[model samples]
Target: MLDARGLVIVFGLALGASACGGDDSSSGGGTGGASGSGGAVGGSGGGATGGTSGAGGGTGGASGSGGAGGGSGTGGSAGSGGAPCFDAKRLWFEDFETGDYSRWTSKTYDKNWNNGFCHDNGFSTAQANSPTHSHRSEITCADTQSHRGYGGLQFAGDSVVPAYTNQGSGIDAPNGVVNTYWSWLEAPYAFQNGKWFSFWTVNNDCGWKDNVITLGLEDTSNKLTPAHIKNTGGTVTFAPNAPGFPMGKWVRTTIYINYHEGVMVTWQDGTKVFEATFSRPDNDICQWHWGAYASGDNDDVVLYEDDNSIWKLGQKWTNFDVEPYFGVTQAVCSP
Candidate 1:
C-alpha cells in the first residue's frame, strides 16, 4: 500500500533537496507571506490565518461556511453544514473554448517519458461534447501506473545548489487559502481490468494525491471507484464509490483543498466522491499538475480534459505563467 510514507520519500528524494539557483530553494515557487482577510467564514477552528493581511490576494475570504464554527484553527471538521459553500472565487479557468493550448502545459512533447508529446497532437475527437474545439491526450508507450512523468519535464533533481528547474511556473498555491481545481474530463478508452489512471491534488504539502487508489474500495467489476476515508485526527469523512462507479463518460471533477482548515473534498459529476480533513507533514498546500494519468497499456488509452478551472476562496488564486505566454513549467519525472 503506497501510503503517506512512500509519498514523503518520493517527494523528498525528488524535490526535498536544495534546488540549485531556483526561485525558492524548495521545489515549489517562491513563497510570499499571503496577506488578505478571510471574510468571517464561520467555523470554530478560528485561526483565520486565511493568508490574511497587507497583501496582493490573500489570507482567504473563507466565509462562515462550516456551521459558523466547528473545529480548531488550522483544522476543520464537518459541521451542521455538510460542506462549505461553493462560492469561492475562481483563480483560473480553461475551456479550450479558445481552441488553443495557451497557459495550458503538457508532457506529450518530451520523448524521454513515453512520447510525452502526444497531448500536443490536434484533437483526437478531444471533446465528447463541446461547442468549440477541444483537445485530448493520448499515450501509447507508458506502461507503469506509479509515479507520473510531469509530461517529460524534470522535477527538482538531487542538487545541493537550488537547481532552477521550472516545472509549471507560478502554478503553486499559496498557503491558507481554499484552492480548487475543476474540469470536465472523460476517458474514452475501454476499461482494462485492473488498469488504473490517476491525477494530482494539493495535499500533504501540496503533493500528489493518487486518485486511483483513494477513489474506491476493491471491487470485482474493475472500474473507477473512489475510497471513503476519514481523518484519524478530525471528524470529516470521505465517501468512496462502489466497484461499479460509472466510467467511459465525461465527468466533472472538482477538488477543494483548504490548507488552513486542513480540509479536502473531491466531487465527480457533482456528487461528493471523497472528502477528508487532515493535518500532517506540516506545510501549506503548494501546487498541482493537470495530468490525465493512466497505467497499463497506455498505448490505447486516451484522456479528455476540458473546461478546466481553478477556484480560490478567501483570496484569488495566483497565476504561474510567464509574460508573452509561451508555456508553463511541469514537473517532468525522471525515468
Candidate 2:
C-alpha cells in the first residue's frame, strides 16, 4: 500500500523539485483564520495564512429543472432554473447522460494505478443529476486497491502548462476558469468508510503522485463529516469533523483556482468549505482525478459524480472577481 509519504516522494520525483517551486510559502490571501468551524452555511474552511478569504457567492436562486431532451449528449437549451446540460465550448464536461463511459480512460500518467475502471459499464441510469445516468465509483476494500476516475481534460507532459496562459493578467485565457463545477453523491454505506474522492497532482513521469489535496468525507457517529486533506511531506487534515456532506444526497462542489495568485477556494452545496494557497502561478496542473483515490480501512464504498464541467470566463479574473458566478444554482438531485 502506498502511504502518504510514499505518494509525496513519488510526485516530487515525477515533477522534479523545480516544478514545485517551494512548499508552505504562501504570502497574503488568508484572512479571519481558517473558517468552517460550525456546520452552518457560509462558515466553512478558510484560505491559507496571509491569504484573504475570497468572498463566496451565496446559494444561487431556485434549482432549475432539467431540459426536456437533455440526455441526448448534446448541448441543449436551459429549462427554467438550470443551465444547458452540455456545452461544447466548455474546457471539458461530463454528464454521463449518453449512457456510456466513452469520455474517460485510464489515468493519463499511471494507467495501471487506475485499476481497470471505466473500461466496462460504470453507469446507473436511475441516479443522475441531469436525468438519465451518472458515473458510479465503487471499491471493494477486500481487494486492498485504490480506485480513481477521470473527468475533464486528459492532461499530459507538454499539454499541462500551456493549457492556460496570461497568468495574473486581467484578461482571460482559453483554459482559465470562469467557473468549474464537480459533485459527489454518497451512496449509503453498510459500514463506516474513509474515501478520498478528488485529487489534483503533478509529477514528471505523468504519474500524478505528489502534493495531493483531497476533498472527502468520513463516517463519524453515523454521520459523514466533510474534510479537505493535504498530503505533502505527510498528511494534514483541514476542516475536520465539519458537517456538510449529507447522506445519500448529491453535494455539488464549486472550485475557484487563481493560478496567478496561487490560491484555491472550494464550495459545497453553495457554501464555502475550503481555501488554500499551495502552488505558484508557474506550476502547471498535471492531472485531475475523481474517485476513490485512497481507500481508507476495509470498507465497501460507492459514490456518484455527474454534471462535471469546466467553464472558462473568456478572460483572466481572480477568485474575488468571479464571486458572482460561483455556487450551486441548479436544483439539488438525490440518488
Per-model TM values vs. the true structure = 0.47, 0.52
**Best TM-score goes to which candidate?**
2
TM-score of 1: 0.47
Report per-prediction Cα RMSD to one decimal.
16.5, 12.9
What lDDT tens digits, residue by residue, belong to model 2 across residues 167-257? 2222133334423333344434532333232222211112222233334443333222222223122223234443455556666655555
Poorest 10 consecutive residues by lDDT, candidate 1? 46-55
- Candidate 1: C-alpha RMSD to true structure equals 16.5
Which portions of model 2 miss their true places by more than 4 Å?
1-89, 105-121, 149-152, 156-184, 187-210, 218-243, 296-298, 316-335
Which regions in candidate 1 have their CA more than 4 angstroms from the true location? 1-87, 105-129, 141-194, 203-245, 296-299, 315-335
Report the CA-based lDDT of candidate 2 relative to the real structure: 0.32
lDDT score of model 1?
A: 0.28
